[model samples]
Target: MIIHVVAIIMELLKLINTFFESALFKKLINRKRSLNYIQFQRADHFLITLSKTCKQ
Candidate 1:
């Protein structure tokens, strides 16, 4: 009985692991990272423009 319970738990863990490593999950992560990068770039550009305008 103990062995059977352990085997079931192991199978559940494997399923969860595969889900995390799936392509859909990877796409979601990449999308989030790109969004953050775009936001950072926009903020940086705004600051640069603001500084240039101030100097002028």
Candidate 2:
């Protein structure tokens, strides 16, 4: 009876681990996309600064 309980617990742990990993992966991807967006915005701001300086 103890062995059976242990087996069930192990299976539950495995399922939980898989769920966490998938969620983590999705979060990382979203983070990377946001970083890219930030970088693009920064580049645009830099270009605007340069253009204004050149016109002055």
Candidate 3:
């Protein structure tokens, strides 16, 4: 019984490792690339706010 449990655990670990090695996992790791537009908008808004504060 213990051996079977260990085998199952190892299989699960292998599957998780394979998932992390896939392209989807790499895309997830590069998630910041997908947020460039959002980041740019946030930066523009911040600059606008700063300019407004400075003017006041």
Top candidate by lDDT: 1
| Tens-digit per-residue lDDT, 12-47, candidate 1 | 656755775799867866878777657756865775
lDDT of 1: 0.66
lDDT per residue (tens digit) for residues 1-56 in model 2: 96686567556656754664697756865778777657755865775575466446
lDDT score for candidate 2 against the true structure: 0.63
Candidate 3 residue-wise lDDT, 1-56, digit = tens: 96686567556656765885799967866876567746755765775575466446
Clashing pairs in 2: none
Clashes of each: 0, 0, 0
In TM-score terms, candidate 1 sits at: 0.48
Q: How does each model score on TM-score? A: 0.48, 0.42, 0.53
* Local accuracy by lDDT, each model: 0.66, 0.63, 0.65
The better-scoring model by TM-score among 1 and 2 is: 1
